[model samples]
Target: MSQSNLFIVMSIIAVISSQPVRGKDCVCELQNSESAFPESKLSRVEITALECIRNISSEKMTEVDRLVLGLQHRLQQLNENVSMLEKEDNGNLYGAVSLRIIQLELAEIQDLLDKLGTTNTNNQQLSTEMADQLRDMKYTIAELENFDHTMVVLKDQENQRIKRHLKLCEEELNATSPPPTPTMGNCGLGQMVNVSGAKTYSLTVYGTSYSFGAWGRDANPVPGDENKYWLVVLSSSNVFGHFVRQYNSLSTILLGIGPTDTHISSSNPTTNTIQGPNMVMYENALYYNCYNTLNVCKFNMTTRTVTNVALPNDAGFNNKFPFAHLASAYSHTDMDFAADESGVYVIYATTSNFGNVVISKVETSTPPVLSQTWSTTLHKKTVTNTFMVCGVLYATRYLDKDTEEIFYSFDTKTNTERYDWRIHIKKLQTNIKFLNYDPRDHLLYVYSDAYILTYEIMFR
Candidate 1:
């Protein structure tokens, strides 16, 4: 070979060698890869999550079946008791008691039916069975009506039904049933307030009542102000209004902490910055998630300066919503700020963990830093509202006009998860936007669509 040809060949070989070997775009052929390294890809969290999914499906079906059976049994017993009373000579005396029992059982069964209807049962067989049971309940209810209508009773007995039923109804209607009463404690109906049926009270601050949304209460009562609670309410004008309340009063009197209309500094620096739904109060600082930016804003009441901390990119802060979702929205439950016994934490849904909650502990630094994080099994879509009681996270789902079921709860202290707490809030209507429990006053405040409702928590 010629020297020129040899030199050209050597140069080409060196150039090709210097260039990296690029492979074709490889698809993730997991099945093929598993055949090579079967045990290398397994993850602990994934395994745990799979097991949890399996257990939840199994346990939910079992629970639905058990609830249906219990309701059926109770209905059967009530029917028998009512029939026996109708057959006796002194039936009217017992008739009232039997009818009362029947009425109570009917309420319980109805509530269970509501729950069964709302539960997302993917199993076809279980869903069919639930439908059948619901039909059976309706039949039972019809039979009860027939029996009441056709029962042969003396004229005195006729009045006896009304009188006894009225008495029983009166006893049930009374909201004074103390917490220790066995029939009422775990009945899921928390103690009823003595005030009007409406649980709402106006926020009277600055000698004038002002309506605002997205509120936060001091973790503990303001220092030196014993019974007085320090509360901050966010207005649509990017302003934070401060208020204080005495121990027994529902009225929120303005404390004049910052400007009457203290504006929060937004990155846009415009008059039309967005407002968020949730906020938490710790020490003398207020922490809230800003709407568009998805940043946690810490507004110091003392310094009157606002600091913003950016959440993780995947923080699922519903930036899609144009305006503030004060009452309710289809996807308004992206993030919520809750203060437990330990400290304040921001609970938000994230895309990274596949529909799970990420709780980040917020330290009250200049630019509040996320201290620690905990993953939760709860999917944000399933819950309507969430609040932290003590150190436990409680989630609610809207069932009906009067019932908000506590469907899921996670206790951070014991590291325990509960699916069916069966604890419920029984109120007049179901327009509650947000509910916060103030431990100091033992009061659960409800923010409905238009008004605010307050209820006293009676402890046994």
Candidate 2:
């Protein structure tokens, strides 16, 4: 080879080596060993490679920015939805429906979050903000989901049943003469004004394994059973009870001694079994929600017979509108039984009334018919529990893990309701599965997470 050709070859090799090598692209033209290499071609190849890298980097950054902007817009919409939900939650008549919509929206947000997480980006601050917003929205969804509102999905059969019940209720109300104005009856304790803190707290005579149950004396006991204390430990799925354990007195229950168990059913979850943790002993019989049905069951402890009366088909049951709080829901607590000085009553919510509390007077007849029904404006989902005192329906809400606020009331006697009451009651546990006012002693009995707590009711 000529010396000049060798120098040209060496120069070509150096220029090729120095230029950036973009993946799988031709950076320089191949030439014969005797041909002179073009300097402009080499310069163009180097410039093209650098521009390619810059363009690729710019495109990636733009994509990241686009994702970030989309995420920000979605987060803004989510915040608005959350704010609207909070504003509309006061009555929350349609809370379950609203929550379902929110759930769908949350799923979309989650999908976007997942997409954002897969992207390669260097904007740590924007990424962190998005992550935080998604997390907070998820937490809100979790808290709302705890309401157990999934039962709001009414099957066709349920819808028909509810319509029929509504018709029956309407016909009954029209057919019968208006009921006499309710009176306070023998309740000498004027209108209930305040409820004292827990006067006593004791674990169940059974154990903590049964996390949900009820214990209280019969509000209207027969001659010899006045002092009888009945304990019902839900022995199946923390939602059904097959027996009642009777203690001779409060002292016996306190000492965890002498509970005579009476089986209400052969199996734990069979028919005629107690469906929920709410029940009340009144006049030698146990009143409760029947298993797998919307009927109130009356079990006469005396005869061992069960008689059930169907509630309005619109009634919420099977955890449709159970008492709930921010953290959890006590399942199957749709039908709450209470007894005031007047008679036994069943408190529940109905779909026709949009999940507002409905109070029905249970006539202690041969079959225990619902004689009169009163609807209240208080939303059942917002309340943790309800009880009756002197024909007044008192509703409670969760204040904290250790407290409950009796914030609203509806007087059946006057068909009037109040929401400004601030009566507070302390709790032994975070959740109260069952609470009822027993007029026998004017005391509030609370079944809280397998523990029993009692409070005194003070009147104005």
Q: What are the root-mean-square deviations of the candidates from the true structure over C-alphas?
A: 28.7, 26.0
lDDT of 1 by residue, 272-333 (tens): 23344466667767677655567887777567667777778876765332112234553344
lDDT of 2 by residue, 1-460 (tens): 4567668878887887878577855354545554343555445545655554554564455555545555554565457556656766347665675567568667766876776776654446545755665565556545443443344434665898999999999898889676875554335567665565565588875678888999899888889786678899888888888999898655458657557888888888999999989999988899999999999999999889999999988898999989888878879989899998899999999989999999999999868999899998888889899998888888899999878999998888778888998878877798888899887667789888888988877654
Candidate 2: regions farther than 4 A off: 1-186
lDDT assessment of candidate 2: 0.79
TM-score of 2: 0.60
The number of residue pairs in model 2 that clash at the backbone is 0
Report backbone clashes per prediction: 3, 0
Model 1 regions more than 4 Å off = 1-212, 225-249, 252-261, 265-274, 319-333, 457-460
- lDDT (0-100) at residue 253 of candidate 1? 27
